[model samples]
Target: MTASLELPDRLAAYLQRSGVALAVSVCEGDAPLMFVNDAFTKLTGYTEDEVKGRNCRFLQGEGTSEEQRQPLHDFVHGLGEDSGRFPILNYRKDGSEFLNYVFMSRIRDSSDAVRYIIASQFDMTNAMQRSKIRQNDETLRTVLSDVEQMGREYGLAMMSSAQQLADSVAMMARLSLRDTR
Candidate 1:
């Protein structure tokens, strides 16, 4: 795809001001670099002229797995005709791999044909690692709490109706006592 129209000043300014990096491509058989912001240039270590008219696949390396490539292929080939997410693990020109969550969309004209593809990328490697650690901690805490609750109610009939379960643990203890009596 080729963009016959120019990027609006407002949208261009917005992309520039946005802290995160972004790159836009116009799919011409293969995805071609149309525009990239300064942040994107800084992140990828590629100059604007060096990337213009080049395919973004240059970022892929041996470390890049098929799991990442397949989804990207599906998005660009199928949903790229519409608008889809192109999240993938991509490498920078510097050979540094990063988790890039990219959302790809098409720019249309009066004829409703794809004119351009705008891909916004978010570097999520750090945030995703942090989230995994937090999730593990949360899971451990939940498991420990469940274990403790089981210890306190050992060999007891913990199962109950929804109304009974909604009651406090103290009320449940009273019910248990009455049952034993």
Candidate 2:
């Protein structure tokens, strides 16, 4: 749905109570957080009182890289459209880290003025870990295949050398017999 349409109170409440994790921030000045749903708290481990009126950057920590923070920074400064699904390493209130996939969009009023920014965060730590495991497995398989190929080549070379040695020994024996005769 387009952000221009004002969400009714009931609809907003429904969103707050919905199963999805989301947070709404007023974009007037510092983009202070205005609302956070129950799911948001459950995901971040921070209560509404702790997060209200604060910038959501509190979720970022040492684990968050500058590259991941740049996109969100550019989006907030009106340098980009929507901040697409970007994965950010974020820390919870208890300092536990998780890969967060964040989607942010601007909500505008009828006059076309920006009113708020709605950000939805999804936990993707498990998916990212699985992807890494698959990549490692592929790398291991490639290494094993190369080693097996080298082994086969070495075996062929050794067999050829043994055949040449046997032929030389047989020729030497025949020459000795001819000399004795």
Candidate 3:
């Protein structure tokens, strides 16, 4: 993307201050990064100076699944018109892992030729982990309920057995008393 086709001053300032991470790359070969907002730098742990000429794929690491990469590849190749959104395993500069929700779209010139690719990345690691924790909590609750039910059943069975034993003792006492009389 040409630096001349700049975002409006007000809008650029707004994006730079946005809480969401945003990045822009040229649409040409390799799609080298052209701009990255402060949030992007914070999220990826890379300054714009370090990433300006590199493709964003540097964020991907060994844990990044191939399934997630395919859709991104297709989107960048113009195979799909809709913006692509996918969760990818990404590693920060410190080798820490995070779940990144990547959303990518193409920007076009007035003549409809693609000019740039703008991508936004949102960290969803906490949200995903919370969801898993909720599921585990539900499972634990179900297991506890089952255990409680079993305990109740066992208690009832024990009570019934004790009552039967008491009745038998009473019958034997009456029989002995009759025999003595």
Candidate 4:
């Protein structure tokens, strides 16, 4: 990425103030990082000065499998146009793990050539946890249904026996009354 190519001042200012974690990489060479927003620093703990001219792969670690990163690699190398979305397990500068949902899109020049790739990353840890919680909730519902069914069966058996006993007592009382008469 050459420092000579710069974003328009108005667009740059807007991106700098945006709340989204944004990164722009040049399509040339290894797709080096050319720009990053403040939100990107907040998410990855890296300043623009430290990441400039470097590939954004620094945030990836052991948690990011080769299969998950291959699409990104292909996109960076201009080998794939369909590589747009990625769910990556990335590491922060403090060594903590975060699930990042990244959306990458290309910027083309007037000649229809690729110029830059803009990526927006969102933290997906909470969404993943919510999905697990929904699964657990479904399991709990199944268990509660089983417990209720068992209780109903037991209660019905007890009620049937009690009714039978009452009928027997009524029959014996009538027999004794008839004999006395």
lDDT, model 2, position 161 = 26
Cα-based lDDT for every prediction:
0.58, 0.62, 0.64, 0.64
Q: For candidate 2, lDDT tens digit of each residue in 77-172? A: 666663345679999999999888776766554445665667767677775578865753464354334333433543422122212222222222
Best by TM-score: 4
Clash tally, candidates in order = 1, 0, 0, 0
Candidate numbers sorted by lDDT from highest down: 4, 3, 2, 1
- Distance from true location, Cα of 76 in model 3, Å: 1.0
The most accurate candidate by lDDT is 4
**Model 2: CA > 4 A from native:** 1-8, 128-181
- The pairs that clash in candidate 1 are 1-27
lDDT of 4 at 97: 92
Q: Least accurate stretch of 10 residues (summed lDDT) in model 1?
A: 161-170
Q: Which residue pairs collide in model 3, if any?
A: none
TM-score for each predicted model, relative to the true structure: 0.62, 0.65, 0.67, 0.67
Superposed model 4: Cα runs more than 4 Å off: 1-4, 129-181
RMSD of each: 19.5, 28.0, 28.2, 28.1
Q: What's the CA error at residue 110 for candidate 2, in Å?
A: 0.5
Model 1 sits at a Cα RMSD from the real structure of 19.5
